[model samples]
Target: MLDTVCGGGGVREAWGWWGRTLGGPVTGPDGAAWLRVAHSPVEKAGGKLWTGPEDAERLVPEPVPRPRLRLVRQWTDGGDAYKAELYDRVAGGTLASGPVLTDAPSLPVAWWSGLRAALGLLSAVRTERTAVRQAYLDRAMPKYLGFLDGGGPVPTTAPAWSTAHGDLHRANLVGPELGILDWEGWGSAPAGYDAALLHVYSLAVPETARRVRAELAAVLDSDAGRFAELVVVTELLQSAERGDNLALVPALRRRAGEVWRAFDGR
Candidate 1:
């Protein structure tokens, strides 16, 4: 399949959920392209984004100037059993060289610029549906509001909502040219939601977190942004209690404390 879509020289070097990714030099094309093959219905939210090129192109607006998807081919059998999308690959490397981050990382100016452009555009734009909703943010799953209530009233209300990238970690972004990969989660969410999520994820590296906070001060310092922080912290706390990403528990707790204090201890 890799050879068929990307020509013979292509190789399967990367992989994703329920599928594998192939990328290599495109013969006679003077460049490279990518292919993703997925099987059947991906019940997970945002699963459909990978199966159709039109969906991505329609949902993610042209925040061009930034490294993003340039669709080449999108084909499916019109059944829930098979789907695939081929995209023109970006020469720029991802935001982080590796998949995981534990230390303070340095990002180039292009990365910052691309991030600002893409996020700024999306933030102003709106989407009808988002995986992250008020219910998901304040879910009763491991309960954080109780603690914040200090044995008093714990309001389950949320703040103003806006468009969000849903997931915007280092792994999903590219650098040099600064490309933001993966648009499955792109939709309307809390205005400061994406920034808060990025900052929380960067908590393992204080310097990086500080850098994000400074660069996105307008979003992170506002009431909407602070509410978004609480949402992410609550989600992380639930995951920690569930024994997932336990290594990040300490950092998440610290982030939660900071968010709690910053949000008037709400």
Candidate 2:
């Protein structure tokens, strides 16, 4: 029998207790097993403490098996699917998307596959009619122009438009099977959006970055400039959506200047 409790933010806190009850090890790629525990302020006491184990059954409605031993706790508010995708309970070797690029042999196949996927995303975006483009542009262009100079190379003129994951950063790609997660922000973008994100994340290791870029460039038949522009635009939009975190504002400003230069050359 599952018990349930209702409160402001104690849902996650209560769920942790349930994980402890199962006695299963929760691990990530780092090989360290740890439990995700949550603590919140006590309503009346104005203090925080660990929610007791008794509250576990109440907080989680039913136990749902995923790739790991995870419990699917549904919120009565809405949606049939639970809010979280917990995978720590699983014993498989986890591979994070970005960092692993350095460990591998820099296979051309991986780069080509990723490039094809990126182009596919861009193609979807281009299929939109004038009105749809204007709608998306209206919401996206203001933020985009802010990153560009007076005259800039627009990503729309690129030769090979492809679908993009929009947010193809390292954290989104994970696992040994290279399963992509966090589809909420996905959409069609530019050809190089995924490659650029992957490249930027790999800046720490120059060798890996070079190899990945080479692989990507090799797969494309034409217009590297257009693909690169798309990457810049996608990254700029991502920065805006993320509240322009990580000093992206200045970077966007710089990219705008670069785009203007590129436009002038064309």
Candidate 3:
């Protein structure tokens, strides 16, 4: 089916696209492009139209430095599945660099600079839901503040929210030029939400985690940022309980304990 979309460009490389979508860098007959396929009746199809590259290309103004999504076209199959052709391939590929399980990427300073620039630029985006609810905070506050689950000190109220990338992990980012992808959840979240999420994802790699925290200190090292980090840590703990990445449990627990200590000190 992808062959028909690109009119036949041999697939150069492919990667799992957020569970429901498929297609990677394709050498199209016309040129290079990416193919994204999804079945209808699934989760949100055409989600990228609003949150992915399209939204960035349309909404984010120039000097913002986001990858432009040139939508070639799209068609729906009889089964309600759809496919779209797009261009704007990243040279450095994903920030994950290689196999997700073993990758320990060493990003350049330029990467951090570009990322900060992009994040600041994205703040201009507005959404209908001004105040986004964070579920992680609900579970984390009790455990960290030592409440009903145990008993210690009460946590402060959640800090203010801001427009942010809902998911910002190494896999969802591209480097060299520093482009962010996987915009399925772009909206108004807590100010440091994206940075916190990325930091949590990197907990297994101490150096990388340290770099992430340092680069995002403006967000991760603040009262609001601490609150955000707790939320992400709780989410990771929940994932561990669900039998997802059981190996992540120890690191997550350690981080959670540290956050609790910090909260107690304050």
Q: Per model, state how many residue pairs clash.
A: 3, 13, 0
Query: Can you write out model 1's per-residue Cα lDDT over 130-213, one digit (the tens) per residue?
Result: 647667655652376456535344334666777777777777766666676666656777678888888888887778888999
Off by over 4 Å in 1: 1-10, 17-30, 42-53, 64-80, 97-100, 149-155, 241-243
Off by over 4 Å in 2: 1-75, 78-134, 146-162, 175-177, 200-209, 218-244, 248-266
How far does residue 225 in candidate 1 sit from its true spot (Å)? Answer: 0.9
Better of 1 and 3 by lDDT: 3
Q: Residues 58-117, candidate 2: write the lDDT tens digits.
A: 221222111332333323233221222233433333334333233543334653464455
Ranked candidates, highest TM-score first: 3, 1, 2
Q: What lDDT is reached at residue 84 by model 1? A: 47
lDDT of 3 by residue, 144-241 (tens): 43522223544535676777776778777887677776555577766777778888888888888888888988878887777777777666666566
RMSD of each: 3.6, 11.7, 3.6
Give the TM-score of each candidate.
0.80, 0.45, 0.81
Clashing pairs in 1: 40-81, 94-174, 95-174
**What TM value does model 1 have?**
0.80
Question: In order, what lDDT does every prediction score?
Answer: 0.64, 0.40, 0.65
Q: Give the 10-residue window scoring lowest on summed lDDT in candidate 2.
A: 45-54
